[model samples]
Target chain A: MNCRQARDLMSAYLDAALSPSLRQDFEEHLQECPACTAELGSLAEVVSLVRSLPEKPVPDGFHQLVMTAVAAAHPAPRAAKVPLWARFDFSRFGRVAWAAAALVIFFGLGLAAGRYLFPASAGSTAYVPPSVTAKPASYDATVATGGNTVTDTVAGIGRQVAYSAKMDLQVQDVRAAAAAVSSLAEQNGGYVEESKITTGWFGRVSAHVKLRVPQAKFQATVDQVGAQGKVISKEITAEDITASYVDVTSKLIALQTQEQQLLDLLRQTTSVDDIVKIQKELEDVRAQIEAIKAAIQNYDSLVAYSAVEVNLSRPLFPWLSVVWPGLGGP
Target chain B: MGPQSPENREALLVQRCQSGDLEAFGELIAPYEKKVYNLAYRMSRDAEEAKDLAQEAFVKAYLALPGFRGEASFATWLFRIVANVCTDALRKRRQQEVVSLGRQVETSDGEVMLELPDAGAGPSDVLEDLERQHAVERAVRSLPAEFRLVVVLRDIHGYSYEEIASIAGVNIGTVKSRLNRARQRLRELLQDGELFEPHNVYKTRAPSKGGAGR
Candidate 1:
């Protein structure tokens, strides 16, 4: 080490922080260079003198002063025996009877008030409970363009429903009917989820096609598929999933908030153990966030695609096939 | 619990403090009051402010007790809070006190007089040791808070570089560089204030703004 290098390493040298080779070089330089050696000596003296400085006694009543501030801030500690009292005090038959009666009376009064205040909440049933006032915020608040599902209708909120339809129809030719249904679904921005066709010995055919269309075109697609053959039976159902969707979405937002809070807590600690503990909690929060995200994505997918099942069959009798058009056949 | 170990006792005290027991909180902070006060004094440079900052540190510690899982010893955790509460309190004020750094002292006379005490000159001719110590304390307090922290922790408190790094939330390399720069600045201050026996025999020019020292 040269004089400049020695000066840089001198502090670490006195602290015994230098590597063996560097220490050797440092000593070699110091032996030849008096100026650097003297400078190092001065630095050492400063360190030692400061270390020798007497510790100032805390001012009188310092502890009392701090404790008073602390007490003012943290006022009360419930006796640790409270839990024990809770466990044992209810064991007496008379006390338990009184407690049960009081609970019933309190609940009855609360119900009466609740009924008076939110009369419509009970009878005008919605998918989400009226009591759950915390609105389910959008998963991604930036893009909320889909006019109606849970993702689009949050906070200002409306029900999120998934619609599906099943139809059994009679057609002159089941194979041709299935292809027409597939084309119709595709034209409506959807796909044929599943399609099956079978031929009987006498050329009678039956086909089943499951079509998935975007929710916006759900009713229109259903009407078109019904027209593919004479509709023998048609069933359409809407499943309200607002409660489950809202529940999952709320959990997601909460977990994200906790993740941020954990990150802030991690910054306040320099202890390796504290960092590790907080990181573990952060990891768990991250995992839960991802899981909730996936669940919301699944909800979005179900709401986006409305399922339509079309079953088409050629009549067993050739004469019945003749009147297939506009005929509700067996 | 017949004569519990210090760690066990501290753990109990912390547990009770977390449980909202004010008395336990008081006991927990009593032993650290002197050390905490001195550090607070170092950062604030005013006795009244130091007292307030020390109390604030304890109050903050009390509020944060639930999160203290004994990862670091109670003393380490508490002193970290002392450093934080005091430094944060001073940060805004420090930003406004833009005194010239060691790098900025205009030594126009070209007399590079560093107050590094010569080996031959003992403490006899200069001020009394106590007076010199007070000067050192003033010089230390004058150092900008960041540099002052490493100096106080390393030189005054005898904390290891690693401990300083942990408390200051900086790496060890930062701790080393900060100590070197702070001590260099302090040497200049002591010499400029005539608090040390200047190595007069072979004095060079004043340290060029920033270039002469590390």
Candidate 2:
């Protein structure tokens, strides 16, 4: 083997990738050639040094940091239990219960729409039964009271409903419209959640406000806000979450009960080991209770206060300038 | 409670992670964090960049866990993600110059001194070793991205050509050629500093039959 051949085969030789005959020839060449031998040695040292470079220790809390980031990106789904109604074997009820439930839902939605569209006129029919309205009355009571019969309530045990409305308006001034929305929400025992005002490409001002108004004032608030400007487009949505709400509420109650039991055990336990184990379990149960409570609270608030998203924009006058030169000025 | 095999443990952890257990994913990645960090550090030669790369790799792995089919070992899959992330970062940074080893600036007195460490600060032996390591690191950093990756994988991380090929998404022949060229370039850089000399070359004994190649 010549020096060139030895140099070409150097990495292969070091890796032991050369065949027997080729390896023999390479070794023979290495025996005769000091330059090839020295070159191979230097290369080997470099490779060895590279391999021996210390492994950099990962920073402290790296796992926690990674987990924190991952959690932020993909939050853990709520561990709410499936509601009894949702898990019910509806097949045994045949199509009668399903048809009756659907009819009640449809009637309930129509009554809700009537109350929203004509608040004064729809009051008599939309009024809740005194018995149901008197029970620990909260957001869920509002849904049950919305012209739904006792039979409807029984069928809708796991049902939750959230209302939201979006309105696009052409206003003389966006700031004024935004102020009116804030005032409307405040007057109705609600509040403005978020508001943003921006000037677009044509220097036309636009304002966006997210309002949370009591379900009772949802239609009124929409109407009041819509009056601020020329109505461009309006969309109202009602999402039924009775199943999810029931599931979350039930889970919260169960977790809270478990937490209380663990707390009781923690107090009565005499053994140190048992105390420690009970305490750990209590802590876990408490955490679950807190999460479930938060979910329930979220559902309650959403059902109690409907979300009103309003977009108000000032009209542009580019056409005025084109038709009559110098007629329009910023 | 009883000692479990690594494969079974890893499979269980992966299952948990796929089912949305973040804590399980954290445990699954504990063993490979240092290796992944080192890989990133060797690629970027910047501690902060390596941290970012390592974090991104883990996050991507976590997000993509549901799609992992166990076709490859978890380590292989993770390393592949790290390699791709590093490659993207290097590509984005391509417009910027690679860090030069001995950057020099003209002084007020027109004395062009090498921009290096002060020689009088430390013990000679310790300083020499540090300087040698620093030089090697810089030389590795200065290599083209492809060559640097192949060299780091094969020589430093001790991956076989086939593994490197899979990680790099290239054929084995490409891995072999890139590794050879990278080693040659490293030798040239060491020679330029007079750190590598032809004399005192030691020959290791050839491996016995059946133990030669990976």
Candidate 3:
């Protein structure tokens, strides 16, 4: 073998790890090459020198020491004894009996308190006293236009709810569609609450609009605006806020009266600094009164008009199915 | 039966031990404790550590007695477990401190002296022999743990290659390779004049086998 090959197998040859044929080849090389043979001899010597060291026996009682340690650490059979003790006294804990009785009494008291606080939660009572109101009839038909669900009414104040349905239009300009929808709301005597445009990759743009329309023209505006593009999805929920609005309106009147009384007190004050402080306090009260009035007015506006949120996509990907609630099958 | 027919007795003890007889297990371990401890001591080169490792090995074997497949002798399996435990102990010790081949001589007066080879061996014939033996022991201790283990099993303990492989978790070829490397290393570590000297134990062999020289 060449010097390179000999070096590669030298370790294995020194280890006596070569196969018979390989061993033969290595032996032939070693016979021919003095340097490799010397190297092998040195490696072998190193291995043997390491192996010849005398072994010192363990000290006396070592087994007992280890076994005692293992016994202390593991103690396997002790666990089995626990079950035997448990079998002898299943209810040995006297305190547990008292605790269990206390738990039962506490649970009973808690149930009684819950029954008194939330009487409506108890469905077993069938007594309909005179204080209770009459049952209302359920809504039958729904006008499923755009993404809004409008219910039919016969006599009671019609609770109209409107919501905008966003869709991707296949048109060239999305801004034009947004302007058209805004104009339609204005023509219906409706006002736009919020509108914004967001830019996309490759000069694409999407428009978002929140608008309010009178309850009377709610369905008509939705139908007119929905004709713009593919409707993606919409959700509409309406609440009968007539009673809540009336309550708030009455509260607002009370607040205005309180503000007027405060103003009168401010005017009658004699001390200069006190008058200034009272006037400041009166102005604060008046500000709160105005805020209350505005809130009531806003609620009235919502009750009178319906809100629609319209999201317009740039129609980047077409030929995709769009399903909107109340716009499809039952 | 041959004087070495402890096999039948061992089998009986093993059966009882398998049945969870503690006394039987003690009996089973009693005879082999010295051998196991010596093997562990050789591997770890520490008396106290060897004892602990050997005991743990036996206990592990005791717990696993039910699963002992009788394909190999229980001694063979026990030796392997001790070897592995000793190897681990030695590795842990190496990590803790560097181990040199410095001699630790114990005197009859209960004194211990740590000295180098030349220092312990004064320029006298008796000291020379002791130094040579010490040198051989130091060389064996210097071997890599793997080759050293094979030499201990083969030469000192006289376990066959198959038994060594079983204990070492290696094949017979690996066992042979380790043995050869260990022997070669031992030979080199010996003074050149001492390499050709034979072991006294081989003197009893027939002439058909090469005559052993000392």
Candidate 4:
């Protein structure tokens, strides 16, 4: 075995990637040639040093940048799930491009915001615009989960009752379910008052959606949403404000009657003192009537729509969102 | 319980990504993101270009995912894309510049014969392993692209010869020959540095016809 042959076998020999007989011949050549053996050592040293080179981390937020570039290039995976972005076919909108437009709008907000912003386009159409919704509003317990209230079964059969519910749900994917819940709200002639996915301490992520579906479909919406994930717990409460409503109405009538009487008394009074006293009493009575009217109106809307606060959470795994790659849905 | 093993999860992610689940693609390649970026860095010395090339490789993988018929492991397939992307990019960059394949340095004036590091510094501080590794990196980076590919893939990245062949789209013999030659070139470059004066230097002078001054 010559020095030339020994040099050829050096790397494979270092890797132990050589045939046994061939390795023996190379080893024999190395034993005879100090120059070739030293050559082999230096080659191994170079290989080792290259192997030990420090790794460079991709720049911070690099993952997000890559995702943004990808989203910009392709239609977001969820764009198909959102019918409006499809119908608008923002494809014609050119640069508005794909579902990734949402990412650009809410960059760093994560997929939860993506799901939220998508269905919100639908919510605006179906949701009760605050302008058109009755004024002097206080009570709209969009929380009622369609469960027949105790008022429905009791002696107050035609009762004006406000139903509100709270539900805890566990889902595999919070953002997807939140989107589905928002869509369901729109389908049921309701609006998502609040849909947010937040990352909490220890990198835990959970979503909460507030839906205001019509009382008629309140139960149906709850059932549909519960079907998306395991229902951790549910609580429904009904406030039969029928008595308060009726009492307020009767007081309103009495106050109006007092105001009319004061008006007539003012017409009869000849002295300025008598007229001034009656005018002040009439104003006070009119204010009472207006207050009662506003209370009754609030009761009417609250009774018509139930409020359901759907608290959707995912099972906490130490390795979930922070570690799992694709869970950051499209 | 960890219901799905890593392999099973990756297979499912690849399928989902193929069907246009961007999230699945992200998950599928999460482990390889840094690896691919480093692979790009190995191909091109420019950090920014490496980042762009790495990102481009992923986007290309995503677009072509539906056709990824599981012939190679997703990693092998993905890495091959990175190599092709980086090599093509490096080739373009190389062409636009005055191609220098010898001990040469760029200056405002033009190409200058490479300056050897101060041999007095020596390799006495092996604990300065980062410095030592970086020195080796300079040697590796100076190698010809063809040689650099197999060397980086095999030595630095620790890919088996068969995998290197598959990734480089070459047969095993080509991989071995290139890797061996690449290493020889690397040793010559290293020996030309800190420790000694051209201990194993081969007379490598790029033909003067291409770059007149060099």
Q: Residue A252, candidate 1: how far off, in angstroms?
A: 51
Comparing 3 and 4 on DockQ, the stronger one = 4
Model 2: which docking level applies? acceptable
**Overall lDDT per candidate, in order of appearance:** 0.72, 0.72, 0.61, 0.70
Candidate 3 local lDDT, A217-326, one digit each (tens): 76677667677764544444555545544433444454455567767877788989878866765675456455545654565566556777787765443211111122
DockQ in order: 0.43, 0.45, 0.12, 0.39
Instruction: Report how far residue B102 has shifted in candidate 1, in Å.
Output: 12
Instruction: Candidate 3: list runs displaced more than 4 Å.
Output: A2-23, A36-330, B1-6, B99-121, B171-214
Candidate 2 vs candidate 4, DockQ winner: 2
Q: After superposition, how far is residue A151 of candidate 1 from its true place, in Å?
A: 70
DockQ, candidate 2, comes to 0.45
How much does each candidate deviate from the true structure in C-alpha RMSD?
A: 23.7, 19.0, 34.6, 28.3
In the range A1-330, model 1's lDDT, one tens digit per residue, is: 678788888788888988899999999999999999888888787777677767777865466556646755764434445566567755566977998989998997777567656655444221221121222222233323333222432354356777778888888877778899999888999988999998768776788899998887887888788777667777777777676676566655566667878999999999998899789778866776666667667777667788899889865643322323233244
Model 2 spans > 4 angstroms off:
A75-330, B1-3, B102-123, B197-214
DockQ of model 1 vs. true complex = 0.43
Give the TM-score of candidate 2 (chain A): 0.50
* CAPRI quality band, candidate 1: acceptable
Worst 10-residue lDDT window, candidate 1 chain A: A125-134
Q: List the per-model TM-score of the A chain.
A: 0.49, 0.50, 0.41, 0.47
Model 4, A21-136: lDDT tens digits are 99888888888889998899889887887787778888544665566457457764333565664567544766546556766656645544554556443222211212212122
